[model samples]
Target chain A: MLALIRSEWLKIRRSVIWLLLLVSPGLAGLIGLFGVREEQPGGPFPWLIALALMTALHAMLFLPLLTGVYAALVCRYEHAGGGWKQLLSLPVTRTRVYIVKFLFVMGLVALTQLLFLAVLLLIGTAKGGGGAIPWSELLGSVGRGWLACLPLAALQLAVSTAWSSFAAPLAVNVVFTIPNMLVANSADYAPYYPWVQPLLAMMPHQNGYDFGAFTLPSLTLLSVVMGSFVVFFLGGWAYFARKAV
Target chain B: MSLRILSAELLKIRRKFIWFLIFLGPIGVVGLQAVNFGLRYDYLVGKVYRDDLWGGLIENVTILMVPTLFIGLAILASMVAGIEHQTNSWKQTLALPVTRTQVFTGKFLLNLLLLLVSTTLVAAGTIVLGIVLGFGTGIPYGVLLKACYYPFLAIVPFIALQNWLSVTFQNQAFPLTVGIAGMVVSMFSIRFGDWFPWKWPYLINAAKEPLYSVACGLAFGLVVLAAGLAHFVRKDVK
Candidate 1:
């Protein structure tokens, strides 16, 4: 698994996709700065809320798309370069290869979320003075957001790997994101849509730490991640194992 | 020969799973609008955000979905062009009797058609939501058409931009990133309004009253499209 991950990392380092992964989060953060500038100071929350919302919107719409494209790009290394046959020809099990690849992709996405948070933290601190930052809230939001996106990341990896078309998974993300955003607003549906769960998890209800209401979201997200991982990993293994170069 | 190449390229796109993305675009938009309508119907029962269904459609659908839609179109367009690069199939395809221009045009036209189909679904969905919400009766047909026309027009340049990027980069991420970055910039650029092409699509979709600015939009789209196609045809593909 570690070897596979190293190989995947090496491949990622060689591609233009890495540059994009690095730049997109920073660009999104810079865009957040503009939103912060425009925020009305007299508003209920600090100007940081606007920045947070902007960052969240960018993440919601683009993050899955990025993951889908990256997964597909990584999968392409095997499919197009005759690397799959070479890798499988070795003693390594097909399931192991799939697991490692999936883990690496998921790790990359998690890193992206972290990088985005880092950019936000840096900006927030710079603008709000050093110690005025809401470290706990920001860290909490990042943790929940990453957890909530686990299912979505798994789903995207599966779809992109299965289809091997950059557009297919991205299209799926786009189609689902709209509903995710809309359904997320309602208390009843927010639990089921894993895409929206991250944002909802980070939102504070009227009551403090409404874990009872959040239980469903937590369970749903966990189920989705596990379910999707099984299906996608099995599916990818099947394809990677039997596919002819 | 051109028609043969065009048909073949279209056939390739049809076979790819990306077609599902195209088909799902409008359906997704419409479905979300229905949900939004259902969720906020009580609050918006008799409220007037603007004069007609155009206003309602603008208020409900355009602001939220257009950015996603544009992103979708750009990514799809890029993938359609870039897949050849990823798979090293461009050389194979180009070695055939087809000219590069025909291949590019065929794929470009297919993307445009898909965009239209997706936008049309969104329009129909918006109108349906308007009626269901009891807001459709007050809207004039011209207002609704005008409202729908702007988003479609606004997406033209983006489609063109994606075409250029996809053809140039052969990596779908490049164009996708641009689409996302452009969307983020447009959110901030909304204050500038007329001068910014990035915000034009959303503004056009969000425009309440029928105005002459739409002509500017159409003209801008045509210019961008022509420039994009020109750049695409002249550029050499690896």
Candidate 2:
């Protein structure tokens, strides 16, 4: 497992996935710096507004979409020129390899979330936000949002494993991801929809503005996130375990 | 320019899930509008009385279509290139009698044609969606078609740029990420001046005269295409 994780980490150094990280946070920062915020300059509790806007673009579409990209890339080399045959011929169990790749994707997503957090703080300070940073609230939302992405990461990994064409999994993810804007709007549908969960977790219910993250308990949120995560992870695991590759 | 290469490219995309993707965007856009109108018919028609509901429907559809168009083009470009990239077959394709420029042009044109087909579906689907919701006979065909199409005309520059990026990079993630970022920025593109290509799709609708975006799209598209083709032609094919 350790060896597998190390190899995955090394593969990323040559890949541009890290550079892709800068896109969403960078765009969100531009949006925060330029767009008019609801909070008066230096008003009390300014974190939520910046977070609200940033996460709307960040977690809602980009995060999930990025997950699919990362997942596909994780398997990109393996799909090329019998790389999978080379890798699997080794003694390592397929389960461990799958778990490690999934972990790497989750780690990449965490890095993205942390980048979002860093950008959030930088934007707040740059704008001369009045109050002290809402460290607990900001961290809490960001963490919850990352937690919500577990199921997505698992599912994307499965699809990426299934498809050799790099863009096919992404196409699948995008078709699902684009609807987050509309799905997140419907109170009846938002909670049940997996793609919309990260956005729901990141923004407080009151700030949702028809985002429909309201009235959900943390325990229920946790169960739903973990429940879907298990289903996807196990399904992907089963598929890979039996896959001809 | 060779009919041989162009037809070959079209044949390659069959059974490759590309057709489903071409159909997905139009249907998804129309489907979302159906839900929107179905649930809130009273709010859309009743509360905003005297406002042409057809115009309102187009407005709502534009918001969805603009992003869909941006992201869709990028994926199409990447998938087109990926057909070769997955097996390191660029050398195989370029070694043919066709010039590299011809191959690149074929991919870009096929993508543009696919989007054109999708856009027509959007126009047709929107009309059907409106009629199904009883939008009545006063269909604003001219404005609806313009709303559906002027953006495609104006967005040719972006099509070139996305094809450029996708062709240059073997990994599709970079181009796809850029496309998503473009989508995010396009949410704010209405505030952008006419010069920005990403803004052109949405701006075509808002501009008093739609031709402004058309001129920009064509002029910029050729330059980008030439630049991309030059790089593609000169670069060492792996």
- Candidate maximizing lDDT: 2
Native contact fraction per model: 0.49, 0.62
- lDDT values of the candidates? 0.65, 0.84
Query: What is the Cα-based TM-score of model 2?
Result: 0.94
DockQ each:
0.49, 0.71
lDDT of 2 by residue, A44-117 (tens): 54567778777777877888888888888899888878888888998899999999999988888898889988
The ten-residue window of minimal lDDT in model 2 chain B covers: B201-210
lDDT of 2 by residue, B118-183 (tens): 999999999999899887979999989989898888778889989989888887888888888887
DockQ of 2: 0.71
Binned by DockQ into CAPRI classes (incorrect, acceptable, medium, high), candidate 1 is acceptable
The CA lDDT at A234 in model 2 is 96
Name the candidate that leads on TM-score.
2
